[model samples]
Target: MTAQEAEDFLRTYRSMLKTWTMAVAGFSNDDSDLLYRQLEADQNVLADIAISYPEKSYSVDLLINSRSRTWAGYAEQRLPRPQNRQS
Candidate 1:
């Protein structure tokens, strides 16, 4: 993938993560501020990763692995395989 595409995916994924974290916090009866904070931190980390690896092409295996964790399952279900083009 191109750097721009990677950046866009990273931005979108982090946004989704934040939204999910907020939903989790809002639904919890007990203090969920810590969870929200953690999510914020995670978002920062993801942003950093995207910046650091802007030109990296993400593989399907990596996506599947990510999907195996937390809410990645939903992301996995939603994301279609990238088309492989022959030059």
Candidate 2:
């Protein structure tokens, strides 16, 4: 993928993550689980983007890693407590 394409994908996934997170906050248990799964899938897509674009991997890696930390923190605060969380 070109750098522009990588960036576009990153932006899309980041938006999806944020939207799903908000939806999860008000969803039923089953719905929340589904949204969480989608969020994880989006994360995988971000990883894939990094791997698929070696030419832009450095910037992509940095963007993905930074957003990951932010996502984790936001999810922790916004989502319900997990039954099987690991430290």
Per-residue lDDT tens digits of candidate 1, residues 1-87? 455756676666555555554454343243334544655555544545545674443432243244235643333245554568342
**lDDT per residue (tens digit) for residues 15-76 in model 2:** 65555556544333335456556666666666677678766567556655644464344333
Model 1: which residue pairs collide?
A: none
The ten-residue window of minimal lDDT in model 1 covers 59-68
Angstrom error of the Cα, residue 32, model 1: value is 14
Query: For every model shown, what is its TM-score relative to the native structure?
Result: 0.34, 0.45
**Whole-model alpha-carbon lDDT for candidate 1:** 0.48
